[model samples]
Target: MTDIHIQPRPVVHQLRAFTPDLPDRTVGELRRLLGLDEVIKLSFNESPYGPSPRVVAALQQAARYVNFYYDPEGRELRDKLAAHYGVGSDYIFLANGADEAITLIAQAYLAPGDEAVIPALTFGTCAFATRLVGAQPVFVPVRQDLAIDLAAMAQAVTPRTKLVYLCNPNNPTGIMIDGSELRRFVAGLPQHIIVLIDEAYAEFVTDPAYLSGMALMPNHANIVTVRTFSKIYGMAALRLGYGIARPELVAMINRVRNPFNVNFLAHVAALAALADTDFHRLVAARNAEQRQRLTEAFTERGWQVCPSQTNFLFADTGQDSAAFCLALARRGIIIRPGHGWQLPSFVRITVGSPEQNDKLLAALRELNGQ
Candidate 1:
């Protein structure tokens, strides 16, 4: 082998245009890094209950046939979803994850110089996808309650604003806009602005004011709701999600979709998870109870925990978030820091099992020097 000096090839301008904000590491990697035997994984809003027993059985049975490719169109899942939402299969578009739907929508609707209006505490993926298409993201600051400031967002839209990103029970902040307010917001927006509502935590929402975007899509052609089985269903490892829109929009986004985007095992798991309504209810109830408990505990201690409808709580720790997360990691717990979101004094903590929550509280108490 000769010593060769070669120049590194630069990535394309589209890729270089923006840096994607995604988790670059895994729980196992972090555990290995800290030389810990086990780490409580609560950084992501995942179901600590895991999926239903049916999903496990179905996946176990499907494991024998890992060599086969799943249906490229994901018809079975799409048909079931269509019926679930009272829509035709043509109105549904499946993808590897909800993030993929966001990307496809941006690709289909956005061109260079276009704009996507989003909240200041917008989900990370929505911003990343918008930037990926070389479109400008016009972010409107949230209200004092940490909910999306829809009026501000509506005012920010112009002729060039192609998309509006709305995250129900938004990530990081975990606050949601009410149904009536959101409808009024949409009504005020220019018809040209397509709304991409990311509803990853929809299943966990117990608030009466919350509404599913899919329920409002029948009359509105501009509405696109992205959902996933990764949260309440505990199938994050499977990477399965979909976009619910009118037939015209689904057709348009489908053009950018890759063939066989959803894997066979994932398709099976999601299918099984749907039929497990009891399991779903159980997880939702547990999350709601735990979320309330955590919020009350934090509030009593003079911490500002935002009211959360999702399976997570965004708390003002009154400390350096990065330092707090590092401390938690060293104590065999994984959590999210808000440095990326520019809230250095805050952290987003996912509601976990009772034991996990207790362990987390203990860690917080120690960090408070109590």
Candidate 2:
């Protein structure tokens, strides 16, 4: 037989498999092992309050239409989002999730030798997407305060730089850049560079100084704002996210977007979720109260807690995070260890419902012998 060998692109060699920061044991397994009544999961920054009742009703009603193909354009959801963001419907690009939107952006705009400026410790997906398209990901380290160093990121841009990625209220640290600083940074960048801002946690932010990247799209043709329904809307399982940009840029990205990437149920859920604004408002209010309570609790315990405007809190427990998380897991509490982000002293805890928070605090207090 003649030898026939095929090889993947060299960029494939640089890729590493992603391992989620979760406990080895399932919630059920942990409950049995620990003889516990409940296993409180505080990872992934998911909404403690599940989706709105309207979303549930919408999905139940939508279940009947599963036999039919979903709208390829996702026009209904896009129209809802456009009206909410005060943009034309043509400027919206819906994807399976914000993660897919990012990858699609890379596919559309990046080529071999292209460079993407990314924050060193934000979300890993941005870097992964950049590498998927054979582009170099230039990592700019966060500032000492753990904020995205916009100036340093701007300095990293060069003639080959085609994209810049930012994550507000950065994961693992929860630090955000101020609105003025972000505006200044974007304004200073070259007009040709595509600026992609991942605002997955935008809806949870209560800080007045924080600004949505979508607000900047009118003036900056190169700016792309990617948002998700997974966070505040409690649609994580539904997998619906969208990007806002100039109509031209959206059209370009749409070229790479798979047809019917978003399913019918997700569209229905998202539209219903949008109309049920009161539910989100209540969730946000609860999150705000719990977020502050958790912050104070961590601070009172001498743990260094970051001021987070998101649904999760990042804290340095002054111990190995893996060990810390494991200790908590033994008591039927699950959280994300920061070892994956190279910060072994920290952990990310998702703010949960009041009862869940009470249990977590009690467990922590017991662990500390308080």
> Which prediction has the highest TM-score against the true structure?
2
**Model 1 clashing residue pairs (backbone):** none
* lDDT tens digits, residue span 118-228, model 2: 989898888999999989999999887778888899889999999999988777677777999999999999989999999998888899999888878878999999999
- In candidate 1, stretches whose alpha carbon ends up further than 4 angstroms from where it belongs are 1-24
Which lDDT value does model 2 have at 337?
Answer: 89
Kindly report which residue stretches of model 2 are placed more than 4 angstroms away from their true locations once superposed. 1-5, 21-37
lDDT of each: 0.86, 0.89
TM-score of each: 0.93, 0.96
